[model samples]
Target: MEQVAVIGAGSWGTALAMVLANNQHNVNVWSHREDQVNEINHHHTNSKYLPDVKLPSNLVANADIQEAVENAKAILLVVPTKAIREVCRKLRPFINTNQTLIHASKGIEPETHKRISEMIEDELGEGVHDQLVVLSGPSHAEEVALKQPTTVTVSSYHLKSAEIAQDLFMNEHFRVYTNEDVVGVEIGGALKNIIALGAGISDGLGYGDNAKAALITRGLAEIARLGTQLNANPLTFAGLTGVGDLIVTCTSQHSRNWRAGNMLGRGYVLQDVLDQMGMVVEGVRTTKAAYQLSQKLNIPMPITEGLYELLFDEKDPKHVVDDLMNRGKTKELEDLSSFL
Candidate 1:
């Protein structure tokens, strides 16, 4: 069995640790909170994140970052987008060659506009390029913790690394697929959260499934536009990490981005929604980054732009919706016609 270190003790990280432990791998879950570490070790529970879910006994917790990564064969970087650099810097000292690096976190870095993999490369310059893998798709931590069936994709510049990650996480209930389209996978995964927030806002505004379905459809188009502009394979957007992830995040109550957006639609201020959720809603931060990126890249992302206004510009949600509906019409396939 392999020794895997999950660098964050958040819901996703803990659930992944459980997956590793269930695969008979020894897992060390690292958290900055001493209480959280204690709870995982002594009580086998992370109540704050995954209520009523029992973690695997073999899955241990560590407050010491050094101890967690010192001997691990693989490391799962599952922290939020903002904390990736800090965590990678913390891991730099203990890392050596021939180690697998997998990042399950989703979101583009706000200021740098970098994908999670890019952030990792910047932080861990050496001994990471050959082993970097991105894990993403429709899977949720809560359901995965319950051992429910979930499918996901792992992508990498190095095909071997992607296949290795697939083996590490694949099981009867947790199916893993491998892809070489790292750009498409990362872009699709990150951008979908923004659309999910829009979906939440639509629901909160008392809009029905028709509205959300349109958001999901058009959101995929926007994501494909940006992703292809960034040199990703367009077909990847039709796969698991693309349309698959979009549907789940936009519809599921498990999505913090969607929940936060819902609150905003219900007339709660941005700060109030963030305060109530008490979690890092990646889409909120991602919207601003995406808005900036779209401008810089000369890509049209109307949905992201609208969400940016609603979230940061203090624009009314209804106005944003109205504006979206009233925008000039164009052939739906104009942007993606080249791919077809």
Candidate 2:
């Protein structure tokens, strides 16, 4: 049994800790909130995040970040994108060269347009760990906590490191696959949240399945466009982290980004929606980053642009949809052919 440390105690982090514990790993979860740590240790519950789910009894919680990573064989960083730098800085002092560092959080860093792995590397620097791996796909934390069947991909610059992460997280209910397309995997995982918010807005605007279907399909096209510009394997968008993640995040009620978008579509103001969710809606930040990146790269991301205008420009959602529909038409296959 290997000792693992999960660096965040949010829903995703807690659920992942349960997965590690179930796999018979000695898992230590670190949370800044003392109350959350106490609740996890004494009651084996993280009610605020995973409301009805009980965490694995073997999964321990730690308030001290140093204590959590002290002897860990692997460390999984699952905090929000905004907190990644802070967490990585905190972890740098304790991280040893032997431990593998993996991150499951998704979202591009606004302004910098850096992926989670890039941000981690910037903060932790070189030679701090065996490898920097990213864990991403369609799996939801709530369902994973219930031991439902889920599959995800792990990617790293090093194939061996990806394989190592795959071995660490794979199980009967939780299957893990390894991919070497770190650029594709990270880009797909991050951009899908932008599409998901659009999906939520579509549904909230009382539009039927037709609108959402168009959003999801064209959204994939937009994602592939930006991804390829960044040198990602075009085929990766067809895989789990790309299409699979987009479908789940865009359609499911479990998605915080979608939920926040729904609130926005239902006429709630941006600040109000954020206040109500009480969680970092990664898509909100991702949309801004993606919008800026698309402009910088001269890539066309209509859906993302629309969402950016709606979220930040205070434009009406229906008007944004109208703007999207009114755009000049182009041959769909013409775009698909470029990826080939």
Candidate 3:
């Protein structure tokens, strides 16, 4: 069995550690919180994150970052987007070019508009870039921790690394697919959170499924628009990380982004919603990054723009909806036609 290190103990990180453990990999999870470490080691449960789940007994938690990656064959970075740089810097001294580096976290860096892979590469250098892989799709931590059937895509600049990641996580219940389009995969994965927040806001406003359906569909177009501009394969947006992820994150109760958006829609302030949720809403930060990127790149992202205004500029959720509905008209497939 391979030894794996998961460098975060949040819900997603804990869930992934369980996956590795269940696959018979010796998995060590590192968390900054000692209390969380103690809980995982002694009780085998991360109550705060996965309240109803029992983590695999083989899954171990480490408070020490160095101890966690001591001899891991692969390392999975599952921290929030904002924490990625710090985590990578902490991991730098412990990591080598030999170990495969994979990140499951989604969201672009607000300052750099960089994907998680780029941020990791920046901190860890090009040696890690060659081995870097991204795990993304519609899979949720809640469902995956319960050993539910979940399929996800792993992508990398190097095909062999992607295949290695595929072998590392593939199992009866956790199916893995490999793709070479890292750009598409990362972009699709990150941008979907923004749309999910919009979807949540739409739902929170009690606009119903009809509004959500429109937001999701149009949101994919917006995502593809920016993704293609970044040199990603357009078809990738139609796959699991694209439409599939958008649909799941936007609709599922398990999505923190959606939940946060719902609260915002229901008339709660941004900080209050975040405080109440007690989790990092990646979408809020991502919305800012995306809004900035769209402005700089001159790409049109109406829903994202609306959400950004709602989250950051304190625009009324209903007014944001009105603004979206009042946007200039264009052919539905205008964006796709260029790609075709």
TM agreement with the true structure for every prediction = 0.98, 0.98, 0.98
lDDT of 2: 0.92
Please, what are the lDDT tens digits per residue for candidate 3 over residues 104-207?
A: 99999886899889999899997777899999999889999999999999999999999999998999999999989999999999999999998888888888
Better of 2 and 3 by lDDT: 2
Full-model lDDT for every candidate? 0.91, 0.92, 0.91
For residue 214, give model 2's deviation from the true position in Å.
0.6
Q: List the residue pairs that clash in candidate 2.
A: none
**Candidate 3 local accuracy as lDDT?**
0.91
The TM-score of predicted model 2 comes to: 0.98
lDDT of 1 by residue, 1-340 (tens): 9989999999999988898899999999999999999999999999999999988889999999999987888999999999999999999989887788999999998878999999999999945887899999998899999999999999999998888888888999999999899999999999999999999999999999999999999999999889988889999999999999999999999999889989988999999998899889999888988999999988888999999998888999999999999999788778555256
TM-score of candidate 1 versus the correct structure, residues matched by position? 0.98
Model 3 TM-score is 0.98
